[model samples]
Target chain A: MAAGGRWRQTLVGFLCLVLPLVSLWYHGRARPTPTLVERGLMRLTSPAQHAMSGVVASLSRVFTDYVWLVGVVEENRDIRRQNEVLAGLVQDREQLRKENRRLKELLRFKGERPELQTLAAQVIAKDVSPFHRVLKVALSAGADDGLERFQPVITPAGVVGHVERALGRYAEVKLAVDSDSRIATAAVGRDVKGTLVGSGDRGDFLATFETLGEAVAPGEEQRPLEAGDMLVTSGEDERYPKGLVVGHIGEGPARQSDLGWVYPVVPSVNFRTLDLVQIVTDHISTAPLDVPR
Target chain B: MSALGQSLSVILITFFLLGVESPLLQELHVSSFPPDLALVPVLWLALHVPPATGMVASLVIGLIKDGFVMGVPVGMYAEISVVTFLVARFLTSKVPIRGLSSLMITTMLLSVLASMLLALLSLLFDPAFQGHGTVLRLAGPVALVSAPFAPLVFFVLDRTDSLFARSRQRDAIFGR
Candidate 1:
């Protein structure tokens, strides 16, 4: 701690600091090969360097696999949640598209015929047993809504039925395929006319085409009521609108039976698959139907 | 301990630290510029020993580092070690060497200064040195990370220096 020793210590530190810069300047100028001391120190430490490299590399793998994978698992869970949300959104989109198409068609059809005021109803249930062909309809009632007795019901496919009774919230319909259902009919591009009567839940769906008022005119297009001929309402019965599709001819030509020609007919609308229908609320008369006896 | 014994022990401790530094930093995924761990003991020697012995030890430790380092010139680290010892000794004199906390803070400060000094010397010496950009890029984060390791390294080196001191004391007592 004497002043001379302190001065010497300070001088030694300064000289030590100066020495390497001088060596660096010389090494830069000479580009000399490493000295014996440098090579000796390298030889001394190389084994330890190699050993630490091997040991620590193994530890890094453990950290990468075990610790880092926890984050990967969390990321995967987030992706799965995103996938579920996307799937539900897609399903809702498809449902909306279908409903949009259906509503657009209904609006167009309503515009096509403005004579009758219509009311919308969802087909809640169907009585498709052998004893009956009735449909249960739930009305989407408006503020001033009311369904009358015997309102003719129709769909985009064609005439479905007529309301048998209005039960305030809903109504039961007598489907066109029931035994008591009747409509004036004529086959397309044919010289014959008849009344289409239903067969009432019969097997094989053999219905209507029972009572022809006129025959094929002297064998002109001899099998006039051929298979696939469309039968449309003639409006002669004061029941359904004219030009409404009632049914189509069955798989065969009409039989020359005693009942003029017993041509098989199938209803245009498939009641089993029907979802929504419209009741022509003011079709026949606003005075209310007699629910024909 | 004798000055020769103390310097040798510093060299021995430095060899292991320089050996472990690269692989350990790589495994720890020390981002950006890796901290210069070889500077740790230079700081210790600066604070503990006489300026002469500490500076010599610093030069030898830097020379040992020259063996492991790839791009740097042979004597550059030797100069860095000597200069770093001088700086650390100056700083600790101004503020007395206290606890591990102060040692860690000083280690961080010294690390950044040493890095800057390295860059400056490289520019003056090695014409191809472009790592002046790295010091600017890291903004001395490598120095920050180098701080935590100081306390542990300081603990180990302190114990080793004390053991040497005690062993020499027993030798003096036995009159050998």
Candidate 2:
């Protein structure tokens, strides 16, 4: 290379290394949070922001509830049909109850269930911009409702999202199905653990395993992640309670050559029509509902 | 009255326009189309006012845009502002006419360019940026939906300036 070109390359190399270090130094020295004055101002403004956020959240909840109300009516009909199928089984329910009670006793012997307090929150406003898929929810209750940040929000359909921003009356829910969002999840039936990521496309997700080298196929096959396979949170994230219905495996790449499963999932909640959700704020376990061993 | 006031007006106008385009008003369902009205002010300031004013206007508006933008981080707006300000400055000398046709063509090109640059910048920083499909899915429709409001914005801004100028001239004549 020419001497000038060599010098230019050297300068560029120096710049590439030096600029980031300078930026790092500058950023490291700078405070990440607002200044005292700014914080004071923010404190004053926060209530308004909270109120506006609440309004947006309530709007999302209203839409979600309206949609979910329709869904519940549909689901109630399905439940009525299933109830009839279960009706004949109800005669044998005493026998099944004994068996279920026995199984619950065994589970009770294993460990106590967490104490769970659920608050029904309504979807108020949704960031339905194709870019952002966040739903805000307002609780009929507030801090009095015992809602807190980092709580898991779910619908009867399944994991709807989680509590992001929380106020006395409302909170912002970042939905599970957001393509950019990830939640720690476990594959049901097979007990495989992985991180579930939203793929932006509806009814699809990508799960990367804690480790790889598991053979997989698409379709339900009495095993975890057998495509059509169901999965749920194992409380590994500690944000969500264990066993909340996440989604079913839509597809998993065959023969993982690495420490990960390329598993796709079908999310349970129809985010577009999601209305009412339950916030799992209290982890109540080993309650009287538990069948003692 | 002063150069600083002249520049401050441009910056304030740009800032106000940025807020106008924000989702805050979309929350109200006021205007059918929230114009990307920043361009009119930027174009006007760059052409009629000083280049320095235009540059500052771009930076203030860009910073506000970045700060308020939910999806992207800050500084991308600042970078775009600098680039757009420079580009507008360069193009001003090249383009002779400052008429409606020119403004329309300029707005179309600049809006498209800003969107493209934003996409490129976003892609460079974010891993999820490969989803150009998603950005286009959002920005393309938003730009198209919001484009028709640009001329209307310029019309109002022009009237405001003319009216203000008329008042100022009358004051001077009346020695008030």
User: Model 2 misses residue A174 by how many Å?
Assistant: 4.5
Instruction: Write one digit per residue (lDDT tens) for candidate 1, span A1-293.
Output: 99999999888877777888876776554232344544464455545555666677677655653454454456587776576567657766986898888788788888866776888887644441223456656676452347665568998777887776444545667777766677777776665678887775434444768656356554444465677888877677777766677778888666665546778887888765577788887653332121111
Tell me how each candidate scores on DockQ against the true complex.
Answer: 0.15, 0.10
Chain B TM-score in each of the candidates? 0.87, 0.72
Model 2, span A79-188: residue lDDT tens: 66566556546646775786576446434522433365677666554452334455556666433645565677876566777765555556666677666566776666
Q: Over 4 Å off in model 2, which ranges?
A: A1-174, A201-212, A215-229, A250-263, A273-293, B1-45, B96-101, B123-143, B167-176
Q: For residues B40-132, could you state the per-residue lDDT of candidate 2 as single tens digits? A: 555555555555545555655655554333333345555566566567667867984345666666666666666676677666654543345
Q: What is the TM-score of chain B in candidate 1?
A: 0.87
TM-score each candidate. 0.45, 0.56
| DockQ, structure candidate 2 | 0.10
Error of 1 at B161 (Å): 2.2
